[model samples]
Target: MDASFDALLDEAAGAPVDGWDFSWLDGRATEQRPSWGYQRLLGERLSAATAALDLQTGGGEVLAGAGPKNFPPTLAATEGWPPNAARATRLLHPLGAALVTHQQGTQLPFCDGAFDLVTSRHPIAVQWPEIARVLTPGGSYFAQHVGGRSNVELTAYFLGPFEVGDSREPEVESAQARAAGLEIVQCRNERLRLEFFDVGAVVWFLRKVVWAVPDFTVERYRERLRELHDHIAREGAFVSTTSRTLIEARKPAP
Candidate 1:
């Protein structure tokens, strides 16, 4: 409603949200990193892998962060969004990695037992059977999944109270992996702190991470955004929790 709110909303709305890079939120927001250091661990795995695949590789940023030197001889990634797919192609091709534009929840285009290592960071959906089908015998799937109810406080603020389902729970996913004939090697879940310093950060976040408020829009949630802006002005920052799960599963050797 106010000039500040309008300016913030316009800035966030107009800013580029094409890639997975969140550098735009540098000072506006902060999120605690997972203790396990997923990138470091992924680098270790990539260094040892003969063939590897990264699913839902948004912008291929994380995979690229693993360092080109650590990349396996055969490295490939899949992304569904065309903008992100193009971004990934530019970032990965020079690193000797192939990028494929593949739809989420659909069967992966790779052949059976094609890769020795599979990885993803915050994949929208995990196709367990497809993951198993693509992994070689004794190969592993290591990923950091978005846990159930992640950032519920932020979502609830905009959408009001809602059912917190078991969609991305580690236990539920592990069971699915087992049913898919993959042995759960390790699973860990952690809740991390997230802080939005201003309303613009919230706007940008909701715009980028569309799942947070499924139907979020500046016009649609203008009143709610104004209220949140006022609250942040008074409180200095709005805090929430982010849930993450690190899972490692392996196919049977036989």
Candidate 2:
């Protein structure tokens, strides 16, 4: 309603939401980190592997941060989103990792037993069979997944109460991986704290993470936004929980 709010909204809406980067929301929002330390674990795994594939590597940010020294001699990454694919190329090419753009949920373009390690962080959707197919016997798949009903409070605010379904449930994912012949070695789930200080941060987050509230538009949800804005203004921040799952599966060795 005020100039500050309007300016913040316009800035968030117009800002580039490319890649998986969230630098813009550094001071406007915050999220508690998972205790398992995914990036640290990934770096350790990458250090030991001879060949590896990173699925849905958003801008190769995590991989690049892990440093080239940790990477295997043969490294490849795939991104489904175009903007991320290009950004990944720019960040990973010099690090000797080839970036490939492929449609999510489709067959992966790699030979059977092509990689010794496969990793992904918050992939849009996991193709269990493909992961098993590309991994050699005894190879491992490590990932941190966005679990079911993550940040549902935020969704409930905009849209009325609705079921999120079991699509991203850990049990469902574990069963699928097992059916694909991958042995579930480790599975951990956690719900972390999330805080949004203003309506602009919420707008930017919804736009960037499109799956959060599909078809979200400020114009369509102006009234709800105003209400949430007022609530945050009065309460200081809007708090919610975000669910995440850490899974490590390995192909059985014959």
The top-ranked prediction according to TM-score is 1
Candidate 1 displacement at residue 199 in angstroms: 0.5
Per-residue lDDT for 1-254 in model 2, tens only?
A: 48877887788889999988899899999999999899999999999999999999998998898769899999999998888899999999999999988899889999999999999999989999999999999999999999988989998888889987998889999999999999999999998999999999999999998888897998898778888888999999999889899999999999
Listed per model in order, the count of residue pairs whose N, CA or C atoms clash below 3 Å is 0, 0
Question: Model 1, stretches more than 4 Å misplaced?
Answer: none
TM accuracy, model 1: 0.99
The model with the greatest lDDT is 1
Q: Superpose all Cα atoms of candidate 1 onto the true structure and report the RMSD in Å to 1 decimal.
A: 0.7
Residue 231 Cα positional deviation in candidate 2, in Å, after optimal superposition: 0.5
Clashing pairs in 2: none
As a whole number from 0 to 100, the lDDT of residue 214 in candidate 2 is 94
TM-score for each predicted model, relative to the true structure: 0.99, 0.98
lDDT of 1 by residue, 1-254 (tens): 38989999999999999879999999999999999999999999999999999999999999999979899899999999999999999999999999999999788999999999999999999999999999999999999999988999999999889999897998999999999999999999999999999899999999999999999999999989999999999999999999999999999999
Q: Tell me each candidate's RMSD, in Å, in order.
A: 0.7, 0.8
What's the true lDDT of residue 18 in model 2? 90
